[model samples]
Target: MKFTCEKSILQEGISTAQKAVTGKSTMPILNGILIKAKNNEITLIGSDIDLSIETKIKAEIIEEGNIVIDARLFGEIIRKLPNDVVSINTIENNSIEILCQKSRFTLIHMNGEDFPLLPSINENMIFSVPQRILRNMIKSTIFATAQDETRPILTGVLFEINNNNLNLVALDGYRLAVRSENLSTDNVISAVIPGKTLSEVSKILEEDDENVNITFTPNHILFNLGYTKIISRLLEGEFIRYNSIIPEEYNLKVIAKRGDLLHCIERASLMAKDGNTNLIKLSMEEENMIITSNSQLGMVREELNIILQGQSLQIAFNSKYLIDVLKIMEEEEIVMEFSSSVSPCVIRNKEINNCTYLVLPVRLLNS
Candidate 1:
C-alpha cells in the first residue's frame, strides 16, 4: 500500500490499534498491524484473538493496496518522524519504505491475507450511549472486578440493560460497586465484559458528548466510536446474583464530608500498611467518628465530625478498599450505612442513588 498522511493523525491511528497487538503471541502475524489503503482512507487493524481494535484516518492514496507491518517498529517510526507529512510505499519482496523529511527506512512486511478476519456484527441488537457517560460508568465499577481467574465471570463487569435504565455491576468478593444511568431504550440485555477490555476502551474514549454505538451477540461485544471500533470476547458464565446481596435496611448511618473522611483514612492507613491485615477501625460515638489503626510498627488515631443517625457502632475494614471508592467519588459529602460490624458497609452518593459501593468489614478480634 502507498499513502501519504499527516504524521500526527497517522500516529494516533497506529497508537490506538496497537493496543490489541500481543507481544508474546506465538503467531508472528498477530504482532503486526494490518494496513489497508483505499479511496483516500487508511484503515489500521490489530488483534490478539480475544480483542481487536481498528481505526481509520484520511490519507492521500497513491496506490490502493494492503499490507501488514510490525506494529512496534511502525509505531515508533511514525512517532519519531521529523516532518509533519509522511509517505509510505510498498516495495518489492514484501517490504515497506517509510519516508519523512530527510529520513527514510525500509522494513519487512507480512501479507495482509494471512491476518484473521474481524467478526462482522449486525446492527440488530445495538444501543447508543454518550461516550463520557459510558466512560464514567466503566471507571466507577471496573476497579472492583476480580483479578483472579478462578471464577472467570467475576473478572468481568456485568452490564444489564432494562428498559431505560442501564446498570453496571462489579465485585471482587470483598467489595461490590454498582453504577446506574438512564438510557433512551426499552430493550433488555445483559453481558459480561472483561475488565481488561473495558480498561483499554476507557483509555481510548474521549470525554465528550458524542455517543458510542454498542452491539453484542452471544459471544462477543462491539463498541463503535467515530472512526474507531473495538471487539472483545464475552465471558461465558452466570454472574453472581448481585441484587440478592444488597441489604434493604441499615441500623446505623453516618454522614461525613468526603474530603475529611478520605484524609483521615489515608492518615490511618499509613500505620495499617505495615500490618499483615491492613485493617482500619471506625467507631461512631455521639457526634464524632474515631478512625484508628494499630500495627506492629505504630498506631494512628484521628477524629472527624459527622452527623450520626440510628445506633452507634464500630466497624473495621481494609483501608485500601475504602480509599479506592473514595478517590473516584466526586461528591462533597457521602453517606455510610452499617447494619452491624460483621455485615457489609454501604457507601452511597447523597444527591442520587446512581452509585453505590458495598464493602465487607473485617471482624475485629476483641469485638
Candidate 2:
C-alpha cells in the first residue's frame, strides 16, 4: 500500500483507533493497526477481539493496497513528525516505509488476513441520542459498575429501552446509579455493555453537539458518530433484576447545596481513610446534617444546614461512595432520602428529576 496524506489527518485517526488495540496479545496481528487505502480514502482499524474501532480519513491515494502496522509505533511516530505531508509505501519483504520531510522509518507489517473480523450488527434495534447527553449518562452510571469478574454481567452497564424512555443502570452491590432520558424509540431492547468499552466510547466521542446512532444486536453493538464507528461485543447472561432492590418510601428528606455536601464528605473521607473502606457517619436532625469520620489517628466532623421535612434519623455510609455520587451530579442542590440506618440511602436531584444514587451504608456506633 502507498499513500501520501496530511500528517494531521493520519495522526488523528491513528490516535482514535489505537485505543482499541490490544496491548498484550499472544497473536502478533492483534497488536497491529490495519491500514487500507482505496478510492482516495484511507481507513484505519484496530481491535482486540471484543472491542473494535474504525475511523476513516481523506487521503490522496497513489496506490490501492492494504497493510498492517504496529498501532502504538505508528501513532507515536506520526504524532512527533512535522506538520507536513506524510508518504507511506509497502516495499519488498512486507516492510512498510514512512517518509516525512528528511526523516525515514520502516515498520514491520503483519498479514491482514490473520486479524479477526469485527462483530457486525445488521437490522438490529437502533436509536439516536445527542452525543453530550449520552456521554453524561455514561459518566453518571458507569462508575457504579461492579469490577468483580465473578459475576461478569454486573461488570457492565445495563441499558434498557421501553416506551420512549432509555435507562442505563450500574451496581456494584454497595452502590447503584440509575439515569434515564426520554427518546422517540418505542422498540424494547436490553443489553449489558462492558464498563471498559463504554468508557472508551465516551472518551472517543467528540465534545460537539452532534447526535450518535446507537444500534444493538443480540451479540454486538455499534456506535456511529462523525467519521468513526465503534463495535463492541455484548456480554451474555441475564442482568440482575435491579428495580426490585430500590426502596420506594423514605420518611426523611433533606436538600442541601451540592458543593457544600461534596466538600464535607470529601473532608470526612480523609479522616475515614485509615478505617476500612473509609466509612463516614451521617446524622440527620430536624434541619441539619452532621458528617463525621473517625480513625485511630484522629476524627473529622462537619455540619451542613439544610431544608428538611419528616422524621429525623441518622445513617452511616462509605465516604467514597457519597463522593462518587457528587462527582457526576450536575445539579445545584441534591436531595437525600433516608428510611433508616440499615436501609439504603437514596440520593437524587432536588428537583425530583434525572438520576438516582442508592448507596448502602456501613455499620456505625448508632447500631
**Model 2 worst lDDT window (10 residues):** 117-126
What 10-residue stretch in candidate 1 is worst by lDDT? 270-279
Cα TM-score per model? 0.98, 0.97
RMSD over all Cα atoms, model 1: 1.0
Q: Which stretches in model 1 have alpha-carbon errors above 4 Å? A: none
Across 240-296, the per-residue lDDT of candidate 2 in tens digits comes to 888898899988888899999999999989898884678888888877899988889
User: Mind sharing the TM-score for model 2?
Assistant: 0.97
Estimate the lDDT of model 1. Answer: 0.92
lDDT of 1 by residue, 11-103 (tens): 999999999997778999999999999999999999988899999999999999989999999999999997589999998878999999899
- For model 2, what is the C-alpha lDDT against the true structure? 0.89
Which candidate number maximizes lDDT?
1
Top-TM-score candidate index? 1
